[model samples]
Target: MTTLSIYQVSKPHRAILQTSDIASILKLLTDAGVPFEQWPIRPLPQNADAAAVLSAYQSEIDRLKAAHGYTTVDVARVTPEHPERVALRQKFIEEHTHPDDEVRFFVEGSGAFYIHLGDQVVRLLCQAGDLISVPAGTKHWFDMGPAPHFTAIRLFVSPEGWVGHFTGNLLPGLVPKLDSAHA
Candidate 1:
């Protein structure tokens, strides 16, 4: 299930609002200029390769690519056992922004995106079949849980791939990560 939780950037541990309702999530994010929606998803067999996963959404991929003038598309996955999982998680968990839109479709597992907009921050818990497009220059951070496990399809306008410009603000360690029990 998809979830949306809102919190003041000064107190991320306490959620001002939380819900699993899709419509509400869309409304809240849309109002903030972030695109959040669900796309069709069909189950893939165990251990499906990246090519196979992309093929499953060929039509959607083609449409988005043409519409956005995306020069490259790639699949990125991180598992609990991945050696660099800790480093990878640490790298993105800090506040940052991209020069181009950060687009992702969660094909498996889940991840949390904390988007800072003005006085409050929106923490979006995105699951499989969820599509999130963070507009370019939006301040945000991502957490893939402590024991990461997710495969995502990433679309890029530029072939250079993800380039994040980190913001010095730490949000004051107020943000909460996925707990070990959940992981």
Candidate 2:
């Protein structure tokens, strides 16, 4: 199930609000100016390649492109067996901001996105079918867990792909990672 948890930046150890309800999730995120939605899950082969995954979600992808002026669309997959899973996970777990909005639609598996607002941090656990759009310059970070496993459709305004500007904030380290939060 998808979950949303909000905590004070000063009180990282305690969440002020936490719920798995979809309506509440949408309301909170929408109020925060974060676009959150769910797309219908499409069927795919046992081991679907990027091409297959893209094909399955082409319509939704097209809609997003037209609506957001995204110039590039691609699929990103990370499995536990990936050679650089550790490195890749570490890279994303650090707090960072992008020059362009970061949009992702999870096709399979799950990941956690920690969005840092004014004085609060929103921890969103996005699973399959969840689509999240993080506006440009937002302070945030993602955790794919120690054993990562997910397939996400990503959209970008810049064809240059993901370019993250690291925010040297130790707040991410102060909060629990995906693995620890779940365990």
Candidate 3:
């Protein structure tokens, strides 16, 4: 199951909205101009099956088009034990935003993505079925939590890779991590 939770930003202990159902989640996010959606895919083969995956990615991108106003979709993949994982993971810790909303769909595996807005640290534990939408220019940082794993379908309005306009690096050292109990 997929979930969506909105923290008031001023409050972290409680959520203004939380839902497991995709429709309800999408409805809440879309209405708020925070785009959201899902993708269904068969497992990829050992050989070059990028086309199949890319096709599915495109379909999801199209869905986001009408839902989130993204003009394009860009896909990025990182394995569980990749060498660059640690550096890339930390590089995203500083809260920032794109020109348009930042939307990510986890195609395989799980990662904890954090969005910091005002006072709330929105920790999103995204599994394979999950899609996350961070409203354009929203101050946020993503921790692909501890280990660098997962394949994400990223939707962007531009051709560039993620570029952040940061809100400084005064990140609070203490925050809850992703766990089964919370998810």
Candidate 4:
């Protein structure tokens, strides 16, 4: 299940709003000019290969590419047990923004995306069925936590690839973490 929780920049305990309803989440995100959605997730058998996952979502991929003018799509997976997970975390833990929109659809596992909007932060917990598109220049950071593990499909408009422009602001730690409660 995907969860959307909005909070004051202060902390998760200071949540301004929280919900698991897809419609409410969509409406709230739409009203805020952020793109959020839930796609019908195809349940793959355990150990299903990446090709199978991609094939299952091909039409949806085409639809999104046509809708958003995205030029390419790729799958990414990260696990806390990966040898370089720590380094990867260090690379992306800080607040950053992209030159183009950061769009992702999770296929498995979960992660937290904290988006800074005005004085508030939206701590979006994305699971297997979730899709979130953070607009270009929106301040945000991601966390897979100490035990990170997730598989996601990424859509890109620029062939140059995903690039992060670090803001040098470290406010994510000040916010609430994604935990059982959020899940």
Candidate 2 lDDT over 1-183, as tens digits, reads 899999888888777888999999999999999999899999999779989999999999999999999999889999999999999999999999999999999999999999999999999999999999999999999999889999999999999989999989999887778877431
Using lDDT as the measure, the top candidate is: 2
- For 52-156, candidate 1 gives per-residue lDDT tens digits of 999998888898888878778899989999999999998998899999889999999999988999989888889999999899999999998789999999999
Badly placed stretches (over 4 Å) of model 1 are 180-183
Worst 10 residues of 1 by lDDT: 174-183
Model 3 worst lDDT window (10 residues): 172-181
**Where's the lowest-lDDT run of ten residues in candidate 2?**
174-183
Q: What local distance difference test score does each model get?
A: 0.87, 0.93, 0.65, 0.83
Q: By TM-score, how accurate is candidate 3?
A: 0.74
Q: Rank by lDDT, descending? A: 2, 1, 4, 3
The residue pairs found clashing in candidate 4 are: none
Residue runs of model 2 more than 4 Å from their true location after superposition: 181-183
Report the backbone clash tally of model 2: 0
Residue by residue across 7-30, what tens digits does model 3's lDDT show?
Answer: 654444455666777667667556
Model 4, which residues run further than 4 Å from truth?
10-13, 179-183
Highest TM-score model number: 2
Please give the clash total of every predicted structure, in order: 0, 0, 1, 0
